[model samples]
Target: MVDVEIIEMYIPNSPSTLIYIPGITSSLTQPELYSTLHQTFSKFGLLYQVSVKNVDSEYYTYIRYYSARAASRARAAALRGEIAIKDSGPVRVTGLSRSGFPNVPLSRYKCEELANFYLGFSGWRSKVLYHRKEESDPLMVKYVSVVSLEFPRDSVSCEGAGLCEQPLASAEEEGDSYIDIITKTAKRSLGEAFLAAWGKVLLIVVEGSKVQVQINTTKEDQFLYNPVWDEPVVSVSEVEYTQDAENEDEV
Candidate 1:
């Protein structure tokens, strides 16, 4: 029996990698401010994203780095009057409190977005080991999917499974609806299964100019996979692994 698991991806909840810069009144445009902020903060580490926002009549910028260590260094530099976003004056940097850190849910689409940006097109790959429909009671239909993900460059791989079930049509339903029902159910099941496989907390590490995704499994609460003991009902023939640059769900 294959050890099927679920990769429950989540953003870091503590040791925040995000910093805030308030009272950033700049003569430069928003884009210029963004660029300046990127250039200024990126010197500490590779940045995940940067944004400038206006609260009331004042402007502030948020800088997010891939590494918490980098954020700490940047924060310390600002505190010591060594770093300034603009020549207007030396600015203060503030780190988000542990409870205030954002922990966004790792949806399938977001996972791919981050992966492609950080890991590049050829850095990782995924293959569907099997996607098979299960024979259950007449009132319900179920599908099971097993997939494998590999980061060839990093030499890391893991297997995950997804299971979805839908209600079967009643005998009174039109016959034509049977095909539609099956198709819709199968697509949902496959999408969910793929999400389970793609969803894992990816800790982005940056060392100067190099960046890599490190699978974060230190938090025991994030491992959310439980497998059923049933035998396989159907299996697909050799499915070749493919690299997808475009945003396409493997359904």
Candidate 2:
């Protein structure tokens, strides 16, 4: 019998929120300090809000971005260590597993865009690109598959459960080493289970009712539809339709 390994995953509750712990002692009460932090983080992406909190002389800043991809990029860059701040010591940046603020409604359309961006594509309408690499040796060929996914409108919340590492049959049963089994399983399952097993999933909550879950999968049909922004569209016509109708009646 194969023994499966169940590992607890560390999934981020909010991908768009990041936490920054400054090395130097600074006061959040100061306007200049707030401005400096805001300006510094804004270079990575569009920021929805910036806030600072202090507990026991320890200062922490929560920076929220409009797009999860932007927050992810900022976190990756910050993880390299020692982000410099003007008139202060270098600070360390880390992404928050869960947002400290109350739940803010996120547009379902925007969430889809963010997911596609993380997968290394311009938009959900874009085509999936597959790259094949051939080494000098015939046995070393590699196959890469790229997939895009979008959740249904009913999805209310998303969570990361961590990597699902299942063990294969024992040496006595299959005559394969543990390492070999693990390698084969990871490669085969990683691509198909990447979003559900590793990536963050967003949930959409309906008011006064139960929440619905939307799983991320290949959005082949969604390619025909471009995302529509929430903002109202302005008409280009200088004259009103009512005025045009009145002129036609006069004629």
Candidate 3:
């Protein structure tokens, strides 16, 4: 194996998150790139989440690991510039500290109207609450449903207009809660509609009566007209690295 020099671009204070900037070569969509990175990085350690974003037609992958050590090791390996995808050149990896990656205010609203407005959807009557914290971060909020809904066959009506209704007791007899049944039905009926409205969605997960919608807000800053994660992780510049090198020589 060829040994490439490891350049510590930015050492984050916490070192739990690492950003990967891939060379321009692949034509995969943001969601597809996210899936590929998640699967590849999952081998290193337990992952909290993986996000992909496009800036100026280039792709960047932000990976957060549960173990800081795992992130550090990944960063070292990535810095060597050895990791690469088929048809893509080596990627640049930079470690991010907690202070480096600032968390934006996340707000959860109970009103469907507000949710619809933020989600950019119209004629949506489901009681799906919206939770948003970052306007530009690639990883958005995840909605998990605990109980499902029951809708009439012909009219497709839910129990409440803006609230998730409790599952019926009879639903337990069939080994599946009413919430689970309704959640699946809703995904089948309204999943496409939601995807069309919210282009940032990464994946949709349904467990029992609950449905989890994972949002990917990559490049949202451009569309939302706001900048959140666009700021540099650290205030310092590359000069810090040169100063450290000179200090080591003096020692």
Candidate 4:
């Protein structure tokens, strides 16, 4: 039997999930600072997003966690002077609450990163199951691709398909551009499909414990369907079994 859980799309826009840290003492322009911040806060829980910005000549950072419990725990730790970055003094953490904040969808790169971070590289795999040219014309070509995502430990697999239309250029010098577009379209389709499937699988970590809650997508995220100017239709859900399962399950 397959353990199927519906990934709910509606994440309550509560302030408890958002954490604000001010006066980091590091230059906000440094790219390494963001990585260090991510590595630090992600330890408390699965982070929704982390960003640092300059405000009034001070470096301020915001850490958003998927789980409010995780946010609370991180705040408690910060209050105790346990959290610091690169010899910076103890950071101050606070919650940012607003009247009606929207739940922005995760990007394809972010989805891949989170999946790898929590599930590990070997925990999940995506394979191209099918591909075909659907239509062609003098100036354009259409192709369709089907991809399968497998999480072996959970005995779960999801299938999704993507459709794309690529424009053809008349100039021979631009042939590489056409091929590159087609290749990118196919990859985007694959990523979009994976986004829809993975979006349903929410990873929530509190303290040291982690949980995966499958939420029913109440509405199709507009972000998942269209990556670029021309939108690709994505279809999902079919299962395949893997023969061998690896034993490196540590989140």
Candidate 5:
């Protein structure tokens, strides 16, 4: 692996209710994550800070490696998001398998109270990983839904979505690197876990999106917009879509 390091930052928006988590095989820097967050949660803010760490080639090793950083980032994200959002109503956390654990204290924005959406696998199992706390607050978690993204029960759809691209094995064999299982899971699971824990889910999948379809579209566009996954994620000027493919002679 050639110096695979991940950078963590918040999406910074408000009136925020929904949160989408990415999957384990990749990082949240993927365009799919940006698009979903940009479109579905438009106007909302992201308050979490991700910790970049070293991962072994065994992506699943994250369960052990990144746990500490995940905890800190979860707490930080929670604090930042909580303060930024005006909605005192329930917050949502949505994601795939590892991301199902977003409820665990991996970022500032993590907590049972903030859980609103959960799209994941082994949800109950993931939630089982959190520490118990006494409830001083009177609110019951407003859980959205738990959609399993595994083999058999493989899909769903909603007004919003969380998309992720997996690490290509060919890239793995060569020097191309990828995020570890811990970061991937931490990024992926929390929101879906929230749903499984809470229950009123509004799940949607991109069964079919037009090439021109738009989602995760953001406001003001002040973002760290880098599409590359193996290095630190950054934001730059948006790229021109090239509008039309090559005309007959232009090809």
Candidate 6:
């Protein structure tokens, strides 16, 4: 069946709030990938609003936020509000190497929009993060620790290898790359420039030059996101992440 888990879920104030998606490789095989695995769904039923239900066996959709394919599918999910995770979509991966790991220790009681950039990414990243120090719940600290423990640190795959590299594309597309398309949105605020506010939205993969944003629009509303004014790329740099071997026990 489609193994959908909410290991450390804390429904934010709005749909636009950042929701963490850990390793898909693990999400597929791990039962705890869902909220029930974390043992907090029924208790905190007030929080989540069932995004995706019975996903079936092989997972129907699996993709990043920067990919065009991912954007289209995720948008469809937000429409139904009950999408199946892991079929296939655009490739919009946010974090590279170990920085991408859902590396939080405590689930915060309240949803806090944390860090805006991923570690060691360069020139407009394909993703953004809620980088937090604690897990959303205190009681679940142990579970979060388990995740931290299980996160692979020095894998060759993280250093740009394996099935991971197939989804990425050029930075020259539409004057954007998988990285630029995402980092731009995560970092820039359209409202700051007297533009319309972006409501509930989901990001697909960052492929070629275009990164898709699946707006959480209603049936009557259009999924088009047009900015009257877009600020040019001023400075895009890489986020360098170096794992201190001495900090091995830090997680």
Query: How well is each residue in 1-251 modelled by candidate 5, as lDDT tens digits?
Result: 23222211122122122233322243433344334333323222222432222244111111111222233343345445541222222223332223322323233234221222122233212222321122322222111212222212323211211222333454456654444422443344444343333232212223111111112223122112222422447776786544446664452
Q: Report every candidate's CA lDDT.
A: 0.65, 0.45, 0.43, 0.65, 0.28, 0.26
lDDT tens digits, residues 32-80, model 2?
6678878887787656567776667666677766545556667776777
Over the stretch 58-173, how does candidate 6's per-residue lDDT look in tens digits? Answer: 32222222122323344444445443334322222232222233422222212112111111122111211121123233222111000000112211110000000111233344
Q: Which stretches of candidate 4 lie over 4 Å from their true place?
A: 1-14, 24-36, 85-88, 99-101, 169-176, 203-251
Candidate 5 colliding pairs, count: 54
Cα lDDT, model 1, residue 150? 84
lDDT-superior candidate, 2 or 4: 4
Model 1 spans with C-alpha error above 4 angstroms? 1-9, 27-51, 76-90, 101-105, 113-120, 132-141, 166-188, 198-251
List where candidate 3 sits over 4 angstroms from the true fold.
Answer: 1-13, 20-25, 97-251
lDDT (Cα, tens digit) per residue for candidate 3, span 1-251: 43222111122224544554544457777777778777777666545557777888878677765345556667776778756665576667754544455433212221232233222354233443322222222222222221112222223322111112223444455786655755544443333223223333221212211223333433132122122334545685456334456577652
Compared with the true structure, what per-residue lDDT tens digits does model 4 show for residues 28-73? 4557888888998888877877888876667788787756667788
- How do the residues 33-130 of candidate 1 rate in per-residue lDDT, one tens digit apiece? 78888888878865667889976655788787655667777888888888765545677777666645565656666566656656788888888766
TM-score, every prediction: 0.57, 0.34, 0.34, 0.65, 0.16, 0.15
**Which 10-residue span in candidate 2 carries the lowest summed lDDT?**
3-12
lDDT for 30 in candidate 5 is 37
Error of 6 at 65 (Å): 20
lDDT computed for candidate 2: 0.45
